[model samples]
Target: MISMFVTDLDGTLLKNNRYITKEDKEALQLLNKKGVDITIATGRSDREVQAVFKELNITGHRISQNGTFTFSKYNENVFSQVFEEGTSLKLFDFLHAFDFPCLISNFDNIHYAKEIPMAQTLQSLFKTPLIYQQDLRNRIEQDFSTSKFMLLGETSELLSLEKKIISLFDTDVSTFLSADMCLDIVPKGADKRRALEALLNQTGIKKQATASIGDGFNDINMLAYTPHSYVMSSAEPKVKLHGKKTVQHVYEAVDDLFCHNLIL
Candidate 1:
């Protein structure tokens, strides 16, 4: 029987990368009524999760920036980590050579350092406001630590960048494709599983009592970490095998878990 459930946003929870469905709302309400703790683990920022919580009228734990940060249900930050200034600058320099829309993100906001004509579109796509910090290096100079670095571009470019990142910064950072065209880079050893472990230790939820669902490469570790896991049906073929089962909606996963627990 699972006492805690963790899910990723975007493609998983947010149907079609947009809004939550009525069924998802019902599932969340049902989980709450059943006294099951909920956690949203995603590559998105905390504010985005809070926005979803606002829409659902629900709150749980949040593991954001691909698990670089973890926050409790009470809104207290239990654990957090970010790229050091030197490393961030080195990455920033490497990223600047590419014309792909680059972003520097923190726990608070997503930022753009170069001219991006499609800024408005990206803002809408990211579901968050994009702040322009003409010089990201300067921001880092102000005691700033970046939560993640992002690049949105063609698949070819992203593929090349992924290889470059792996070859150049293999031990310095972790990079993965969060979406079809979006590649995200975070501090080394940071991932959903590591962050979830921090949350579990604080909340006293054992791995056996936890279930998670996700549909992205960044979610692979998380799906593997939790004993009971689900993969979204719409996810890439390679990602589906990580979960014990596949579901198209959050409610279905909840229902399956409830049945396993003999609660239904």
Candidate 2:
């Protein structure tokens, strides 16, 4: 009865190298043949997500920026949630207290506080322009309107910063740890679940017909909301606990869920 397959990109769908495995590709093809809608929900930007789709030959609606934006593979915008101008400025001021690097994602570009090692690493991985700026506040105000903000640093530092930001903002913004060293911020209540709801509303798909797969903490809300939820076997314990079932990998689940029945 599952009509939609919602997957997280990093560590869930894509391998560590950021490429879809042949097994995953075959699984998706099988799902398509069975009339299932395969979609993606991730913390990446539209540009990054599009690149992934092109590499995988996937055509589906994508929920990006941890649900701040939703668009289709055909480059159509379906939904978006942007931070208020004042909120953006407040966050920028607060982040200035920390020395760790950060990136601000607008509709089309990524702006950095300063050139950092992590920025360079991500540039090599994503192949997107990384604009270095001395004054992020001015740069954000002038060049682009931010949809989401991300911070990269050690886990302890990021956690400490997350606590402080939440205490100060007091629910003014939503915060999530996508990885051990990564913190993603969006407007309060703007999460993957909210984005899933919006997508369901737009496509007239019921909750019972949806399935979500993920491998991280940021994906918990969306997994909880879906009726048929799955977590990767390689996911952290907390993430694994949220799903009704766990699979060894994206392809294993896809193969079992869609292909095994074909020969019978």
Cα-based lDDT for every prediction: 0.87, 0.80
Off by over 4 Å in 2: 73-76, 259-264
Separately for all candidates shown, the number of backbone clashes (residues 3 or more apart, or on different chains) is 0, 0
RMSD of each: 1.3, 2.3
The prediction achieving the highest TM-score against the true structure is: 1
Residue 64 in candidate 1, Cα distance off native in Å: 0.6
How do the residues 76-140 of candidate 1 rate in per-residue lDDT, one tens digit apiece? 88889899888888899999988889888888989988989988777776678889988678888
Model 1 vs. true fold: TM: 0.96
Candidate 1, superposed: residue stretches over 4 Å from native: 262-264
- By summed lDDT, which 10 consecutive residues of candidate 2 come out lowest? 255-264
Candidates in order, TM-scores: namely 0.96, 0.92
- lDDT string, candidate 2, 1-264, tens digits: 677888998888877736787888878766766777778898888777777767667677889889989875455677888887888889988886688777888878778876687666778655468778778788667656788888988988898889889999866789988866789988888888988898888788899888889988899999999977889888889888889889867776665555534212
| Residue 34 displacement (Å), model 2 | 2.9
Error of 1 at 263 (Å): 4.6
User: Model 2 residue 206 lDDT?
Assistant: 90
